[model samples]
Target chain A: MRKREPRVILSFPATVDAMSMESYSAAHGVPGRLIPLPTAISAGCGMCWCAPITDREAVERAARDAGLRVSGVHEMML
Target chain B: MIYLDNAATTLHKPPQVIEAVAEAMRSSGNPARGAHGSSLQASRTVYGARAKIAALFHCPRPDHVVFTSNVTEALNTAINGLIRPGDHVITTDLEHNSVLRPLYRLAAERDVALDFVPADRRGNLDYAMFSQLMRPNTRAIVCTHASNLTGNLVDLRQVSAAARAGGALLIVDAAQTAGCLPIDMEALGIDVLCFTGHKGLMGPQGTGGLCVRAGVEIAPLKVGGTGVQSYSPTQPAEYPTRLEAGTLNAHGIAGLSAAVDYLNEIGIPAIHEKETALMRRFLRGVRDIPGVTVYGDFSGDRAAIVALNIRDYDSGEVSDALAQDYGIATRPGAHCAPRMHRALGTEQQGAVRFSFSWYNTEAETDQAIRAVRELAEE
Candidate 1:
């Protein structure tokens, strides 16, 4: 079994942005999943991207390469 | 602007809802499926949420609550999983499309027999008629806790009694009533309870689940890797993992947990009292307005939803006017209960709905009253 660890969580300001991140990352082979923004991060609600810590460089590269604006990113155990 | 479309979804969630969701993302990993530290923490967070939901609904076991994408999926899972071919299922006219659409599809595809108990002109169901509809193959009785259109509440005790007597399981769609109304799963004999987090629970959209009582099993609607028993091609046969076959909506659950915590802190009784009071005030203000016809029972049994129409205006027109001119947001048309509207004789011109929530204020109710009165006069 692959060991899983909570990585830095990134939240976009809009639903479309988060969705775009998903599309961009998948096309470029970036590793992450779009999930509803975790509650501990904010009481206000929307979706965000949960990437594995090991894939941080690839995700960031994908975001930059795809010309997607990055949102707030915080490292958490989740 | 006043927001009275809570039946569709609650507008503003509690502050903790956001905080909890963020915290979950920061601190937790995939729950109950791993042995690593982060995974264990994630598992604990999920279990804590399950306990919170169990406490809220008074479920005997926390494991009984299974998460889904939304109430629609939950309803589909329960209805489709339980009813075999040629089985009979009893439902009512007050159901939202989430319940009705899936059952209708099952009836056509799986050959299940479906009987709908007609509601009164005001959208109240007659339990006597429902009792008579029970047949030998009646496997389940599925009904909404409150009508999404009219906000009329069914007598669950009566329905539970009837289902129990007929040897049928009772499924209640608590999308509108879970956080706003008091419900005890064990005491009420509800074998299956479906709830949406976005509505009364005040969480974000895309979060909902079903609470399965002991001895009830719902097949997985979609099969995939549940991060457990990955070697096996078939779905896991555990309580929640059996049905939750995919990457779980951990973020939604995190927000849902916060929403549930907010409700618990304020208390359901207090929230209900606050909302029902607003309902009464709005009812009183709109009842005597000329050309305004209200739907649903005015007797306070319903939740915060109310449907009404201006005498000569189309529901859409009134809704647009309310939004554009009055700055009040209200839902117009069938409200996803087309059959209920048909039963209420409002199918031709669906009524406008004003659904309230705990965050709604007395001043907002007054604003809605003034707006409707102005629209009615015009």
Candidate 2:
């Protein structure tokens, strides 16, 4: 198993929102990749944007500019 | 054969659309169902298509675009999800059965009241009737942007004004006009815009969807397996996920995405101009032909369609003759527009319909005109 580390997870209510976030991030150099919604997070059963904890601010800013339908933001250990 | 029945479904598609579908079949996995590269690729392709459709129709939110199997499914979703029991709805005689049947079922099963804005013998709607048909309990005004049978474009601005004045939602079925015409849902005051990707959009047959306005809420027709809220008994109450359930047609959507790009590159106005020109040419040739009677008003903006009957002959016989004798293809009979046919007073004879697409050439148009002339003479 990999060693545990802190990660910033952004959750969306729908898969389309997460995909939008991914698209916006790719276009604007936001730092994140989509991962399956971590079971620890109770938002929804769809994909969520996961990034390094240090890049949380940048990711949040990108999502705001993109007007993505993000449901929740969480920081957790992986 | 020179295929002219484009309103039914475009017989020719851009090569990019074909290639995109082939590529998706080779590479894509189930979208939003997994985190693997293939699944993500499928997800991205589907999302890309949604964004393209949203932009093309001027839908405010990309996430609000929900994919369905075809215009029939899209219309079903919009009609069934929004209209409630005892709600007063206004449609038009120009609507295809996709709009009529659902509203009919609602009238039968849900106690909904429906009134249709009548069309004249020329297939032109009396736009003033839109407001007159409105009731205090009116929930929506559902109609087509253009008639599939006659090719007459409805005056949506007038319809939108009526809907707004009556405080009712305007749901437009863009089956005949979507990719062939530029539609700004916001500008047109459309609450829900239903479109099929195959006909004017020149995509795979299985692709279509509805674009809902931000604040509009539609109860889903089918609910299960959205891949979100898996444990919840209720469907996720989000824009798209609220309506979309089960696996999506990602491959078809991939093709639709490419088709949109192709349309963008060519520009919609240019395509409309070419198609309208072909339609006018065909009209000029056949309108003066003896024993020929044509349907629809050609004096205003319309789709590239011409419906005509030759010398009291059955429309099926004329269409079959066009195919077997002239090597030309056209649609015949009811066209799922029983009301439109009745309005034109051709309910018994039906009509031979020739619809044009961007892929059709002047030579093909002239050939179709010649075929119709010979058939009328016979």
**Tens-digit lDDT track for model 1 on B207-236?**
888899978988778887655444556876
lDDT of 2 by residue, B207-280 (tens): 99999999999999999998887888899999899999999999999999999999999999999999999999
- Maximum-DockQ candidate: 2
RMSD of 1: 12.7
Best by TM-score: 2
Best-performing candidate as measured by lDDT: 2
Whole-model alpha-carbon lDDT for candidate 2: 0.94
What is the DockQ score, from 0 to 1, of model 1?
0.02
Cα lDDT of model 1 by residue, A1-78, tens digit: 546577867765433345456666766777887665666776544456788887877777776775554557777777
Off by over 4 Å in 1: A1-78
Each model's TM-score for chain A is 0.82, 0.92
